[model samples]
Target chain A: MLKYNFKYEWLLLIRNRWIQVLTILLFILFGFAAYNGTQKVKMRTSNLTSAINELQIKEREILSQLDSLEAGHELNISRWMMPTNPVVTGNLLPRVVNMPPKSTAFISTGQSDLFAHYVQPIVTGEDSTMNFKEMTSPTQLLFGSFDLTFVIVYLLPLLIIAFSFNILASERERGSLKLLASQPINIRVWVLQKLGLRFFWLVMVIIITLSLVFIIFDFDIKTNWMSFITLLSIIIAYTLFWFVLAFATNIWIRSSAKNAITLIGFWILFVLLSPTLINQISNTLYPIPSRTLMLNEMRSIKSEAIKKQDEILDNFLRNHPEYATNDSKQARGFYQKYMATQQLIQDELKPLLSEFESQINNQHKLVNASSWFSPALIVQNSLNQIAGTSTGDYQNFKRQSIIFSKEWRNFFKPMLFKGEKFKKSDYKNLPEFRYRYASVNTYSKTFWLIIISSLILFLVLTPNKHQIELIS
Target chain B: MILTNNLTKSYGGLTALDALNLEVKEGEIYCLLGANGAGKTTTINLLLGFLKPTSGRAFINKLDVVEHSKLTKQYLAYIPENLMLYPSLNAIENLDYFSGIANKSFNKKTLQSILTEAGLQESAFYKPVSKYSKGMRQKVGVAIALAKDAKVLLLDEPTSGLDPKASFEFGKLLQKLRQKGVATLMATHDLFRAKEVATTIGIMKDGQLKQQWHVDDISLSDLEKNYLETMSYNTIEL
Candidate 1:
């Protein structure tokens, strides 16, 4: 029976020239998206690699100049190696760590474009303002690219609906339904066979397209196998959801035109309207703090901490008795240093930074939890997490930047306090920024739950046999 | 065989088929004559299990039409007035689709022969039904019924748009099916054709079957006059 249905379905689908054209167009689109994604990833990787090499050469040249000037007892040439010099600081090459696109990254570019590729800490009091200049734009961040995930989640379902909405309704309208129903099997079996055939075709298309993408990109297969499978399963379940919707609509609607209209309405609601509305509602519910407010608060903390610099250093000495001394001149020398002021400012502003980060995380959590009502948002979030390109990545990056800032402060504070000259080897020992990619295991639960819920919805909403007969 | 025991159907507050009882036996040609909106089409729809009964029961070949819908459908075929087909497919393709769906396997040659047997023109066999005339489309409908080999056939205005020659030819096909013991239930307005072919004639009015006559008992002219008077519609003034 399945073979019979499959043969007939294949013939019918191929017979409709429009459906054939649509299938070809979808294949072309998928190929175009995958190619575009691969090229973008390659371009970024090349640029970052060359930039890191050039920066390393400059760093070595500056270090050599500093060493020669130090030997000659010349302060002007040695001063070029100071942390205050932007060229020296920029050439330090803060680890140059990048999250390269995985095999499935082509599937969903996600938030990779919105965030920065590198982060470095300076002697400034503001940690939030320390990211690369290239990552600060808001316009490109809002209007995203047309990635593979967008094609699967947004366009695929529409195509599925167009293919399946008239499956049974058209038969009835053409007066063949009654003739078909006068067969050996029941209506349930017949409809199930029809749906099963279409599902088989849809799955074939998904597998074919994804396989082509994998083969063409030659991406890392070892670590990405699970993510790839998860994406494919999600695609299947998502397409099935639309198929069930179209099937149910076919049963309820009397005319082919009515079925088309009703199914398109459903697509628009779930795919387009729901996500937009939910995003608006979430923003209205929990608005993020303005940058102006954050900056002003940081400024207030900096001023207060700078005013109490002597007191803060005294407190630090008391806490660490090993560093304490009864020699009044040495202690007075440490208290009068400029580095002591920077340390005092950082110590005071740590709590403020923590509070700000927590508030932003809380906002993210609200959005994540609110995604239950909109599958589009859930899919988007899941894709971003898989690609390691979400707002969460930016948050992690911010935390890393703060840690780098602390390391920078610690490295210079002792030198200034003890009145020692910074040696050339100290430059090599300076801390570098490193970003850890979030593991897929962290989000496996949410992903599976969404897939299960989508399947349940597809099953629960499919029209029953008796209802189909009556309506048809 | 088909049977309805006080079958009733209502749309909102208006009754379409009001406690009507009917039975059609094997090898019997039962023609129901009625004016527009007189419950004839509603009765056929109920027997086909398209609409549920408001009250009472309907059965096809002793199987309850509602409970054994699939079983009942297997024993019946329906031909609507318009005989719509998939406009994209030719006659042979349409026949193949419907026959395959009905689980009736037939080769291309056999299907073409069946279309010819149904009196469809050989030239139109491979042409899309969209280009076929009303009579040719009806011939395809008959061909579908023939392919199904249904035990009972239900038709609505089966001869409405056919020419005299085509109507006579369709009557001959009905007679042939009746001779083979296939029960036929038809709702039609053609009184002359009904008198010529129907073995049992019934007149329905206001959702009720008001009169019935066996062809053996009533004269042709008498049956026609009585049918017009019972339906309360005059074909000829004065």
Candidate 2:
């Protein structure tokens, strides 16, 4: 029966132009989305490459000057502007710290469009001053990029509803269902076979279109085959979830229009409403302090710290007597006092910073704990994880790069305070930035949840074998 | 091949079939005659296991219909008043699909032959049923019944919309199936056709069988008079 149903349904769908129309639609959607994603990736790569190349050009000139200085040549540059000085070198020769796109980054724009891919971390800049968000239009953020995840998580279910919503209802409406019920078979099995055939065809079309899109966009499938498979699994599982809903609605609802309305209602509830509600609740429950208020607090604290700079420096020298040399000139230098004052300011702002961190962490915890209410959020977040552009991914990058920035600053602090000359070999020991993705097994969770939900819906709608009546 | 044992069906104090005891054996055409709401269609639905009996049982091929609904359906073929099929499917394709649904696979040649035997014109064999007339669709339904080789056939107003000639032709098809040892229970208002085809006839009114007779004992006009008298008598009793 399944085989016959497959053969006939394929013929019917093709004759009805459903297959041709959906294939074209999916191809256009995937093609456009892949193009957009690759464009974003291209821009980031271009920015990083240009930054690195320009830095190389500057480095060559600086190295020539350093060689001249090492040969006992005197230059007219100012004290602070000279590259031979360790403070000058640390402040001027900052490396381009960047987060490169992952192998499957083209699958989803996710939070990538919202954040900057690269930052120049200088010794003088504070972690609080590291802005990771790029300057993007609010309208663009409101209407997010068209990506493969958007197509799968939002639009594919609608297509499934359009395809399968009328399967049973149309039979009953056309008066063929009575004839169908007379056959020596369970009605639910009949419905299951019909829906299964449609699912099979739609999955095939999606896989083909997505593969073509990937090939056209140069997705590097040979290197990221596992991620590609995961992407396909997520898509198939999500498609089944919608197909199961269509099956349930077909049996439970009596009218084709009603079935469409009910399935569409489910789609909107799960895809659009639930995530917004969750986000609203999370924000309301764990409210973070306003950035404006935080800025005011930082300003007042810095003002207070500047007034007490001399006091904090004296206290610091008294505690670390090793730095209190016989020549008080070195002890009373501007940076020595400034470095001590900066340390005091950072220490004083610790509680305020920790407050923000704890609150934001609580919000993320809320989103994670309640994401199961909507399968859309679950699949979207997982796809974002595959692309390495989720909010968590950017947060991890921001945290690591901040730590490296502090380390880079601290490495130059000792040289600056001692008024020591920066040598050519010292550049080799400067800290470099490396980004490590957050190790998360998010794929299996979404897959299992969606698969289990679909099976449960099937079992629930079909009931025991041969129980459905021929006529209502 | 068909039996109803004191079968009763009611919905919320309104009885649709009341303690109806009846039987139609091999090669017997039991035509049930009734006005509207006479439990004729109700009885057919009950025998098909479409509605569970309230107080008794319906059996097909000696198997309790409720207990072995799908198994009993293996030997049964049903055609409603409309004989609705997939409109997009041609007559031969419709026969093939329904027969396949019954787990009886036939080649295209055999299906076309069965369609031709059922009196459908060869020219219309491949035309979609959406373009078919009511009588033409009924012929395709008969083709499906023939293709399935069903032993029991249930028809509800099976010839209601046919012309006189088509109605006479359908009577002949029923006679042919009867000759093939198929048991038939047809519910209709066509007294003349009933007297022509039925071996035994029953008259029902207000969910109860009012009369039973062998058609050999009555004429066509006499049966119509008897049907009118029984319904009027039922109204008087009500």
Candidate 3:
């Protein structure tokens, strides 16, 4: 029975041009999304390359100046502007702390568009100065980029609803369902086989379309094979979720238009409404402290720290007397006082900073725990994680970048404190930054959840028990 | 092949079909005659197991329909007022699909022969059913029933909208099936065709079977007069 239904459904879909239309539509959607994703990634790469090239040019010129000055041949350079000073080198020639795109980064825009990929963290800059958020236009963020994640998590279910919403209702509407019911095959089983065949075909089309999109977008499929598989699995699962909803609506609702409207209502509820509602509830429950108020507190702390810089430096030296006693010169400079004051201010603002961090952490925890309520959130979060562009991924990057920034500062701190020179050899020992993504393997959970939801809906619409209601 | 013992169905206070006793044996065509709101369709629906009997039972081949809806359907075929076939599928495809669901798989040649036997045009065999006339679609339904080789047939107003020629052709098909000893129950409004084709006729009004007769015992005009009298008496009672 399943084989016959599959064969005829294939024939019908082909003859009616539904398959052709879907193929073309899917290709166009995937192609356009991939194009947008690759364009964004390309811009990021181009910008990083340009910045590195410009920095290298400056480095070469600075190295030549240091060499010439060391050889006693710097006639035109000013004394204070010299790179020979360790503080000068630390403040002026900051290395680029960058989070390069991961292998599957192009699969989803995720939080990529909202955050900067690279930052230049100089010794004078505070940890908070390494802002992760980019200077993108608010309008752009509001509308969002049309990437594959958006397509899979948001638009794909709508496409499935359009494909399968009226599967059984159309049969009944066309007056064939009664005829179908009279056959020896159970109607629900028949409907299941019908939808299952559609799910199979849709999965096939997706695998082909996504593979083509990956190839066209120049994604490294061989290296990111697991992520690719995970992506397809999530997509298939999410697609199954929508098809199950359509199945339920098809049997529970009597008319084709009514089935469509009901399925679409579910779509809006699951895909569109739930995410925003969850986020709103999370925010309302665990509110992020006001950034404006925090900024004002930061200004006041900085002001107070500057006024008490001498006293803070004295106290820092009193605590660590080695630097004071070991230096025979017994000298102090701008960095000595500034570093001490910076530490004091950071210590004062730690609680304020962690308040916001904790709230954000709580919000993330909320999203993670409640994402099961909506498959869209689950799939979207999974895709973002796969792409290595989720909010958590960026937060990890920022956290690591702050740690690296402190390490870089500490590398230069001793030289500055000892009032020593920065040699040409020191450039090789400068701290560098590397970004690592936090991987979460939630695909299995998401895939199984969607499949289970489909099965539950299937069992709920069992043939004999509810088919009478369907007829009525 | 079909039986109902005090079969009844109701929706709250409104009864769709009252207590009814009916039997249709092999080679017998039981034609149910009625007006718009009569229990003719209710009886067929009950026999098809599409609706449960409120207080009694329906059976096919001596198997209880409600308890064994799918099992009893093994030997049954049904055609509704509108013979709905998949519009996107051709006559042969629709026939093969419907018959295939009944566990009767047929190849192209066999399906085409069946459709042709049911009086579908050879030219229209491969055309989509959406383009076919109502009468042509009914032929495909008949072909499905033929392909299924069903022992009992249930039809609800199958001749309602068919033209005279199509109606005559449909009566001929029923006669052919009856000759093969297939039990048939059809709900219809066509008194003339019902008298001509059915082995026995039952007239229903307001969910009650008001009259029953063997077709040989009555003429077409007599059946019509009996139907009108039954309707007029219901109005008088009202």
Candidate 4:
């Protein structure tokens, strides 16, 4: 029975040349998106690798020069010159801990465009300036990429709705509903079979397109397994949601034109309007603190600590009495210690940072919970999370920035306090930053919540066997 | 083999079919005659299970139309006034699609023969319906009903838009279906066609059946006069 239904569906679809054209167009778009994303990943990885190697060579040259100067008894002069060269202080090299694109990354570009490519860690209280512009332009961020994820989450559902919204209503309008109803199969089963056939076609296209992307990109097979599965699951559930909606709408609407219009309106509301509206509301609810305000606060703390350097030093010495009887030169070097004190004050403002971050996270939680009503938004959020290109990724970078600051302060403090010359061997001892990828398990609750909600909605909205009510 | 007892349908406040009772036996051509809004279409819709009666029971072959809808549908075929077909498909394709939905599959030769038997021209059988006339579309509809091998056939204004020649041909086709033991319930305003094809003719007015008679019991001219008088506001003491 199912085979016959499927064959019949294919015949109908073939007979309607518009559907065939639409299917071909979707396949082409999928291929194009995957190709572009793979190229972007390869180009970015190559650029970062070349930059890192060049910076490493520059660092080696500076170290050799410092060694030569030390042998000629010019150590003090070389020490003073170190701060002028960014390479000597390791400030030029960005601590880029990249979460490289997975095999399915092409499917959803997500927040990759909006975020920074690499983050550079600075020594506490040095320069205190942030670069506003990076490699990409703001225009690119605003006009997001047409990646695989965008195709699946935004475009695919529309296609499904367009194809399926009038599945039954057209029959009704054309005076064939009675003929169809007179058939041996149940109405609900007929609708399911029709939806299943279309979904089968859609999934086949997606699987083929993604498989091609994987091969072309030479994606790491073992590591990207989970991301691939998540991508597939999201696509399936998202498509199913739209199919079910079309089914429900067809049952209620009396005319094919009305069904198409209403379903398209629903598609626009959920996919396009809801997420954008929620994002705007969230931004208003938890506005990120102005970068200027944060910079001003840091500057004020630094100047205040510098002006009362003697008092701060006295307090520190009293607290750690073991250091009180050290050389007077150590005590007199309060100007050198002022930067560390200012860093301490900045660290103390952590509660304020937490408050701000918590507000944003709360807004995210609100949006995530609201996915019960809009499956498109849920699928989109899930895709972004799996791609490692969300706001959460930025938060992870911020945390890594703090860790890098601590390492930088520790690396310099020993040399500055003990009055020892910085040697080439010490450079190897400096901590290198590495970013840890958050586990997909963090989103398990959200994933299940959306799945359960969608199922519950399907069950609730679906009519019972005994109750056959014509909507019009 | 179709029956309705006190079948009533109302659209919000207006009653389209009011306490209407009708019975169609196997091999019977029951023609329901009425003016506009006389509940002829509503009766056909009820028998077809397209609409539920507000307060009555409708049965097809002893199976309740509402309770055993799928089973009832298996015994039925419906052709509406316009006989709309998938415009992109030819007559053969349209017949195949409708029959396929009813789980009936026929070979190309059998389908062509059915189309020919319904009086569709050989040249137009393979051409897309976008070029087909209203009569050609109705012939395809009859071919679909023939392919289904339905026990009951329901039609709404079956010959409303056809020319006299086409109407005569359709009346001959309905007679052939009657000989095959298929009960047919048709709603039409064409009194002359009804007189030629129907075994039993019923006149309806203001959502009520005013009269029912076997063709042998009433003369054609008297039936036409009675139908017109029943439709208008006149005192007919008969």
Candidate 5:
């Protein structure tokens, strides 16, 4: 019976033009989404490359200047602008700390639009006040990018509903259900086989279309084959979930219109309402300190440190007497006082920064704990993880960059306090920033979705007295 | 091969079929005639196991319909008033699917032959059923029953809106099935078709069987007159 059902259902769907229409629709949707995603990735890569090239050019110019000065040539530049001054070199030639986009970054635009891809962290810049968000259109942030994740999470379920909401009700409306019920087969099994075949065909269509889109877009599938396979698995599992809902509705609802309405209602609840409600609830429960208040507090601390810089340096020298040189001829410079004040400002801002961190962490925990209420949220999070553009990824980059900034500042600190000259050879030992991705378990959410879909399918297949009685 | 013993069905305070006892044997055609809201359709539904009887039992080939609903369907084929096949499928394809659901599989050639044997035209066999008329669709339904090798048939107003020539063709198809030793119980308001095809006839009114006859013993005019009298009597009594 299953074999026959599969054979005939394929025939019927083809003859009805369902397969052809679906193929064309999926191609258009996936093709456009892939194009958008790849465009965004290209822009990000270009920005990072340009920044690196600019930094290299500056370094070469500085090295040439140092060569001229060592040769005792009278340079056109001012004494303060000289590369022999460590303070001048350190403040002018900052390293570009960047987070390179991952191979699967094109799959989701996630938080990429909300944050900066690279930052030039200078020695004088405060680590606690590093601006990670780049300049972006507020309107663009309001309406997110139409990447592959958007197509899969929001539009795919609607197509499934349109394809399957009428499976059994249409038969009953056309008067064929009487004949169907008369046959020596369980109506539930028949509905299941029919929906199952449709789901199989739909999954095949998605795979083919997505593969074609990827090929056309020159997406590097060979190197990222595992990520691609995980993506396909997530899509197929999500499709199965929608198909199971369609099956349940077709069996229980008596009219095609009502079934469609009910399915659309479920879509609204799961895709639209659940994620928004969860976000709102998490925000309400674990509120973070206001950004304006933290910024104002940081500014006040920096102003007070600047006024007391001489005292701060005296206290700093008393704490670290090794930096108190025995040569009375060593004169204290402006950088020495500024560095001490920067240290004092950082120390003063620690408690407020920790409070912000704790509150934000609590919000993330709440969101993660409640994400199970919506599969849309899980898919969104999983896609972001695969792309390495999640909030956690950016936070990791910021943390690493901050530590490197400290090392960059400390490297110049000793030279400034001891009145040592900066040289071309010193460039070799300058600290470089490297970004790492946060670890993610990509398959667990997909596994849970499959399990939930299977459980629903089991419940739908289980015969109940009400269903039988309703059939009669 | 089909029998009902004191089968009754009712809604609260309203009986749809009242203690209806009837038997349809192999190689027999029994036509049940009645007006709207009569027990003819209810009896057919009960016999098909689509509706469980409130009291008593229905059997197909000595297997109780309610207890062995799935097994009983193996020996029976049904056609309702509007015999709808998958509009996207052709006559042959529709026959193949319906027969397949009854656990019968046949090659395309066999399916086409079955459609032809059921009186569907050769040209119409490959055309989509969406383009088919009422009579053409009914022929496909008959093709399905023939392919299943059904021992019994339950039809509810199967020829409600068919034209005269189509109606005559349908009667001929029933006569052919009757000769194959199929027990048929059909519910209809067409007294003429009933007389032409039935070996035995029953007239029902207001959920009760009011009259029974052997088709050989009653003329078509007599059957019509008796049916009208029974219907008008109920109206008069009310």
Candidate 6:
């Protein structure tokens, strides 16, 4: 019976031109999404490269000035701004701490659109007060880019619903159901076979069209083949979830238009309403502190610390006598007082900043736990993780850059307090930033999706109370 | 063989089929004549096991229909008023599919042969059924019964909309099935077609069988007069 159903369904779909129309539609959707995603990645890479090259040029000029100063040559510069001064050299050049794009970065924009990929961290800047978010236009932020993730998470299920919604209802509407019921076969099994064949054909179309789009958009498939295969696995699983919903609606609903409306309602619930509702609940549960209030507190701490700079310096020298100069001149400069005041302000503001971090972390945990309620959220997070552009990735970048900023500041602290001269050898010892992407486990997500879809299919096929009600 | 004993069906206060009893043996066609709302369709639905009987039994080939609904369907074939086939499929494809569902597999040549034997032209066998007339579609329905080699055939108003030549051809096809010893029961409003094809005939009105007869014992004019008199409609000679 299944063999006959498969053969006839294939013939009908082909002869009716459904397959041809579906293939063309998929090609257009995938091609446009890939083009948008790849263009965004290209622009990010270009900006990061230019920042690094610009910093390298400045470093070379600083090195030449240091070489001239060491040869006892009188350079055309003021005494305070001399190359021999460690404070002057540290304030002159800063390192470009950056996070480069990952191999699968073109798969999704994710949080990449919200944050800057690189920052030039100077010795005197405060790590807690640094801005990592980009200055994007409000309109761009309101309506995000139409990338591949958006297409898969939002549009694919509507196509599946349109394809399989009328598999059984059309038979009854055409006056052939009585004839079909007279045969020695179960109606449920027949509907299953028909819908299963449609799902198989749709999967084939998706794989072929996605691969073609990647090739046309010049995606590096050879190097990112593992990510590509994982992507296809997630897509197949998500597709199965929607097909199972279609099967249930086809069995339970009695008319073609009613079946379509019911499936579309499911689509809206699972793909749109559930995720937004979960996010809203998570936020209400674990509220994040206001950035404006935190900034205001930080400003007050800095002004108070500046008024008491001398007393703060004296206390700092008493605690760390190693930074106290033994030279008889005991020459104190602006940096000597400024570094102490900055440290005092940072110490005062630590707990407020820690509370802010804790709240944001709690929000993330709440969102992750609640994401299980919606498959769209699960698949969206998986795609973002695969692309290495998730919110967690950006947070990790911010954390690492802050640690590197402190290290750069500490590297110059010893020379600034001890009042030592800057040397060419110290240039090579400056700190650099190296980003590490967080590891992801998408196989488990795909497995859970398949299991859920199978469970729904099983329940729909079984003869239960709901099945009886639907049939009657 | 097809048999029913005191079959009854009712909805609350209205009895659609009231204690109906009938039988069709091998090589016999029983024509059930009735008007609209006369329990003709209700009896057929009860026989098909599509509805539960209020009180009584129906059997096909000695198997109780309600107890072995799927099993009894193996020995019977049904054709509704307007038999529908897949519009996108040709006659041979539709035949192969319907036969395949009955656990019957046939080669293309064999399917074509069965269709031709059922009175469908060879040229129309490969054309899409969407372009076929009502008579051509009914011929395909007959071809399906032939392929299944059914022991019983149940039809509802199969000749209601056909022209004179098509109706005559359909009557001839029923005579051919009768020669094959297929017990057939058909519900219709045409007295002339029934008299020409049925071995025995019964007329029903208001959920009761008014009369029964062997086709040879009654003339066409007498059957028409009896039908009109039983229906309580005043008649005038032309």
Best by TM-score: 5
Model 5, B82-182: lDDT tens per residue?
Answer: 98788888887788888887889899999988988999999898888999999988888888899999999998898899999999999999999999999
What is the C-alpha lDDT profile of model 4 across A78-119, one tens digit per residue? 543563333236453334544455445555666666555455
- Write out the backbone clash pairs for model 3: none
lDDT of each: 0.72, 0.85, 0.85, 0.73, 0.88, 0.88
Question: Across residues A1-472, which tens digit of lDDT does each residue of candidate 2 receive?
Answer: 6656766788678878999999999999989888888888888788889988988888787777788888899888887778877667777878788889887887789888888887888766667778888888899898988988888899888889999998878888888887788888887778878998999999999999999989888787898888888888877878877888887777777799999899989998999999999999999999999989988999999999889888988887777665555565545666677778877878888899889888989999899789877789888988999899998998898888888888888888767655677777787798888888887567666567677666767575656533544255
Determine which window of 10 residues in candidate 6 chain A has minimal summed lDDT.
Answer: A463-472
Chain A TM-scores for all candidates read 0.83, 0.95, 0.96, 0.85, 0.96, 0.95
DockQ of 1: 0.39
Candidate 2 RMSD to the real structure:
2.8
Against the hidden reference, what TM-scores do the models get? 0.86, 0.95, 0.95, 0.85, 0.97, 0.95
Alpha-carbon lDDT of model 3: 0.85
Error of 5 at A395 (Å): 1.6
DockQ of every predicted complex? 0.39, 0.61, 0.76, 0.38, 0.77, 0.64
Q: After superposing candidate 3, which stretches have Cα over 4 Å from the reference?
A: A325-329, A451-455, A458-464, B233-238
Residue A434 alpha-carbon offset, candidate 4, angstroms: 2.7
**Candidate 1 TM-score over all chains jointly:** 0.86
Relative to the real complex, the DockQ score for model 2 comes to: 0.61
TM-score: the better of candidates 4 and 5: 5
**How well does candidate 3 reproduce the true complex, by DockQ?**
0.76
lDDT (Cα, tens digit) per residue for candidate 1, span B145-204: 888888899998989998998889889888978987889999999989998899999999
Model 6 agreement with the true structure over B1-238: per-residue lDDT tens digits: 8999998889899999889999999989999998898988888877777778899999999999888888988888888899999998999999999999899999999999999888999999999999999999999999999999999999999998999999999889988998999999999999999999999999998888889999999999999999998888777878
Task: Compare candidates 2 and 4 on TM-score and give the better one.
Answer: 2
Clashing pairs in 1: none
Instruction: Give the residue spans of candidate 6 off by over 4 A.
Output: A77-92, A328-331, A465-472
RMSD of each: 4.1, 2.8, 2.8, 4.3, 2.1, 2.1
What candidate 2 gets wrong by more than 4 Å, as runs, is A317-329, A458-470, B233-238
lDDT of 3 by residue, A61-83 (tens): 88888788778785586655678
